[model samples]
Target: MTAQAARHHAEGRLAEAVTAYTDALRLDRRNPALLSGFGLVLRDLGQIDGAATCFEAAFALDPGCVDAADSLGTLRAGQGRFAEAEACHRAALVHCADRAPFWNNLANALSRQGRAAAALAAWRRAVLLDPALPEALSNLGGGLCDAERLDEAERTHRRALRLMPDEPQANNNFGHALQARLRHAEAARWFRRALALDPGYAAALCNLGLAVQRLGDGTLAERLYGRALRATPDLPLARFNRGLLRLERGDLAEGWAGYGWRFASGQAGGTRPPRLPAWRGEDLAGKRLLVWGEQGVGDTILFSSLCGEAIARARSVVIETDRRLVPLFARSFPAALVRPHGPGAAAVPDCDLHTPIGSLARVFRRDLSAFPGPAGGWLVPDPARVALWRERVATLGPGLRVGIGWRSALVTESRRAAYSRLDQWGALFAVPGVVFVTLQHGACEAERVAAEDLFGVAIHRWDDLDLTDDFDGTAALMANLDLVIAPATAVGELAAALGVPVWRFGGRDWTQLGTAVRPWFPAQRLFQPQGGEDTPGVLRRMAGQLDSRLI
Candidate 1:
């Protein structure tokens, strides 16, 4: 090749190099060297089929042309023809048995085909052959990350970064490992650096958004998601996050449709069993609909109320719910069939239509004005369970049967927004003539310990309440309570559904559309932070409300 063609190829000016290589090949049509050079240039230009043709022509003339074989293999790998790529790589290995790049390319093909063990071994061989192969190191780290060996993945990422400190993939991989460790701030910093190194780094941008969202700065998170979408509109997770923000804002039209990407984008997994088809917009007239639970117990209870509404749109309704609440829901929605959720949970195939219990609101939800008021009393406390609870509460003395919950699930890392400190709960604890009963589980171990340590008064304990921490327990407890005070979770929803009086503490920026007074739950009262999430003020208000309600 001419010096000009070589310079163009070296500078990554693939189109110019392709033109020059084509000109040289046309003059020496039968020259295997010229044909091989032309193929490499075509491959660099992303003209993979053309590159394969040129590589075939070169290999036909010189059967042992390992470069031509390797190029063809790499092209086939990019096209997802893993078997063909493996054949070409093996052929190239016969001629050049120690080529690390060829081995790395073979590993890439193997990893794509779900042969991760073989991929790791091949990658180890490539790294052994060429210790400076940063690409091989990075790919190996990703494979380890997929296998959940996060410590090994972290070490491998650091190794790749040492070779190339600004490598976007290495930085992104390191961020992922940090995120798995719950080091959101550190993860966000790494992802930001990756984005700075490659401004169009879509994966880095998405990770940064997720990290910030975990940190409870939805404003910054939304901006990062927008930036990612600007860089790549088709990035599904970015679209999904944007949709979540919109949904949170109550912009249902665009939000619900964008929300559909979770299942379609391969994010929400366990791939909804194929035996049950998704409820596409089809005819539901006179058909039985089986609405089943898919997420947490609280989410199940909060959304299950919509099942009766869904039944209004179908011929018959059947519900599959968490086993803890199956008896309760069966008793409540007797018009519809109800079953406890379990392995091989039978779906009423007799139902022509089906939707997740959560999706009922998506299909039939109405405007705020139309949010059906508390319908059936699905959450009645079992007479037996309530009697046991009464006996338990009676032991604490009947100042007032005040149930308390101060923690949410561990689904997100934003703890400060979800739960005020134990001292915040002191507002009600100090209130005269009230017994503080613990209903929350998990994370509160510290709070519980501190409360007992700080104050000699041991608050009433019912840790064995068998309450599933879902709204059902809340429902049963609310029915027996003088008043309920809890964080913004499914319990709050349960209290609302039961039309039982509750004091709800919420984040500062909760949707203004749903004011502190919720119409859906007539007895529900919301208490938000006055200045900057004043937990004391929320408790003080709850104490005052309880004093007024009882006296």
Candidate 2:
């Protein structure tokens, strides 16, 4: 009977194996080996609880049954009980320390518990025991990448590929390593290869879309995302990428729906634990609502525009925002309670409902026509700080007072191309009556020196102000400027929020939606490069516009 059951399992007839195993177990109920075999067949049939019982009985009957312990560990790991899984794996290893599969299973449990170092060690041991284990090699490569050891990760992934050339996951992971190094074209080829091996590979398809997007081919990227979605409709990555693409093309309805997938896709940063129910455009007439910030500082500023609408609907609103913006938000929305994110967040009064700041767009600005027009500015800078900067600007000899920020905090190749080089701003610097004030934050001393030498203009710098940490001070300085020219960084968003005249530069980013102007900021004008034109051409066009306005 056991031989027949084993033959059925080997032939992939799981139901027949389960039936045969049950008959054998009934005949010899005390046999630990029979119970362990039955447990494995039950597990394959997805009867987790039944399988667990059989494994437990087998272990109790004979504690030396390493297979039973290993099987139990795998079952517990699948159930998200990592501690129990670890104990089972440890017990199994005591009996068979050299078993590569047991070590790999232990590594999986450790990885799930966020013990990266321990997981990596176990994976190394497993690979050392069985050098031909492709899965262990692939996992080890991923762990190396997580630790930022890119060179080792690349080599390990290549080794895995050499062992199993058609392994979909190994190919996908190798592409990810290349993508991290910004080698998008090479990464795209690997992703294509993965798709060739497994046509319905959703993750590979989505990654291919991202690579194509970085290559400045949004159209192809959109099609690739579509293919991914067709393969796996519930894939969050494909949905999220498709959403951004649709929004960039001005398809608001579908775009906003896709945008809702951000939280599930792990793209949103600083997400708080879900304590209160999410508001789905429901009535908040008498409810205390919490609108917490998600994503970057720039997104917080841009989306804060919708607070007024929420304030009008809700009885009382509590806004949880970045600490730097707390004072600004408190003053801006006097009717609501503004609290800084982290530590003291729990001290705030409980709310009837909560919503993410970005989610407000889904409710209020679903259509382009639904967007609010210039309500002057929602954020108000300190009048005292404004006056201080106003007096300081008098030392610059009284020109047009144009503030310039030529870089974003993100220094990726695509972002750099969108922002342009400091030397490319020569045309704008040559404008007759313009004096450039440096609003750029971070390490820009070298860029500033190069720009001054290359463009023959003094780009003024203020060492006293910490632009990165002191956004309040930055806003005050921006309020006193005649105009600010920047990329789609937080600087542009901040200046526009303060009602400063901002000429913002960007490529085909979703935020602007390929429009001449964005509905979120009336004080800003969008400057896009002409067909096949580089940053120099865009700057020249901006210089012409500045010349017309100043003259």
Candidate 3:
């Protein structure tokens, strides 16, 4: 009967195997081999609890049942119980210390727990134990990629692919390694290979969408996200990426709904435990609500536009924002208590509900109609400092004061194209009767000097003002400017928020909320390189506009 049950399972007759195993187990309840075999049948049938019970019984019946323990450990790993899975795998490894699969299992659990160094060592040991093990090789390649040993990762992944040519996961993982190296086109091909192997593979579909997104096809990327969601409805990554697409295109309705999936998709901002339940668009009537800042400084400023709406609805509001923005925010929202966030955050009064600043859009800015503002922007700058800058700017002679930020301080590989080089701003600088001032943050003295030498136009910079840390000072200075020209970065956002006329550029800003201008700031105008137009061409066009419109 046991042999028949094993034969049924081996032939892929899972239902028949389950029945055979039940009949065999009824005959010999104390038999560890029978119990262990029964556990496999149950596990394959999706009866996880029953399978666990069978494995436990088998191990109890015979303490030497390493297979039963290993099976149980795999079940634990599948349930997202990594620590328990690690414990179970370790127990199995004690008796079967030489087993490559046991080490691989242990390594997988450790990897999930974010113990990268230990996981790498375990994967190496597993590969050393059995150099031909495809799973170990694939996992080791991923570890190498995480450690940024791209060359080693590519070699390891190539070997894994050679060993398991038909494995979709191996192909997908190799594509991930390529994507990490910014080889999106090559990565897309590997993702396609993975998709060809398994049409319903959700992960590969999401990865393919990311590659397409990097190639600048937001429409196709969104469609791929839809496909991935269709493949796996609960996939957080697809949902999160789709949300970003919708938001960027000014589809606030669906975008905000999808944006909430960011935390679940393993995007940052979930590090600190919540003191209160997440506020999911619930009515704040009489409820003390906390709106916390997230993402970057620009994001915090942009999202704070919705804080006014939050204040109107909630009984009281406590805003926790970037430390530098505290003074500016405190003056802007005088009704609410404003505090700086991050380590050593000041004592915030208890709140009934809490939400990240980004999440406020899902409730307040559901549509363009929800974005009605007082105009001139929401944030307020210090009147005294504004007067101080006004006097200082008067000394620069009779010309339109234009603050310029050429690039962001936090430019990553993906964001490289979003910002322009200092030389690209030469066309705008060459415009007559324009006093170009440096609002460019971080260290850019070389670029400033080079710009002056290249274009023979001086970009006036303040030696006293700290552009990076002093937001209140920056706000005051920006308030005195006649106009601000920059990318879709902090300077643009801040100037616009201060009600200063800003000519902002870069790409399709989703913050426009599907309009000709940014709804969050009525004082701003957007510019982008149309068709095949490059950065300098766009800047030249902007100069023409400045001459006719403002000069």
lDDT: the better of candidates 1 and 2:
2
TM-score of each: 0.66, 0.83, 0.79
Select the stronger candidate by TM-score from 1 and 3: 3
Identify the runs in model 2 with alpha carbons over 4 angstroms from their true place: 1-7, 20-40, 48-132, 139-155, 176-189, 209-227, 343-349, 413-416, 421-432, 449-457
Which is the leading candidate under TM-score? Answer: 2
The CA lDDT at 418 in model 2 is 67
Q: Cα lDDT for residue 405, model 1?
A: 77
Candidate 3 lDDT over residue span 323-342, tens digit each: 89999999999989898776
- Poorest lDDT segment (10 consecutive residues) of candidate 2: 409-418
On a 0 to 100 scale, what is the lDDT of residue 272 in model 3? 46
Task: Please write out the lDDT profile of model 1 over residues 1-551, one tens digit for every residue.
Answer: 65677789989988788788878877889887778888888777778788899898888888788889888888888776998898888788888879898889888888866688998988888889998899988887877776666788788878988998988878887888778767899999899889889989987898899899878887898899889888988788888776666666666656666566665444553324425666854667887777777656666766666676666667887777767677778767777888875556663356665676655555665345556564434455566766766666677776777777776755343344567667666656766777776666565667777886775546666555544544355455567777777887666666655656677787633232234454345456678776664677777787777777667
Estimate every model's Cα lDDT from 0 to 1.
Answer: 0.72, 0.88, 0.87
Residue 190 CA displacement from its true place in model 3, Å: 2.7
Clash pairs, model 3 backbone: none
Task: Give the poorly placed runs of model 3, Cα more than 4 Å off.
Answer: 1-159, 177-186, 210-223, 248-250, 268-273, 342-349, 391-398, 443-446, 449-457, 547-551
Per-residue error (Å), model 2, residue 433: 3.5
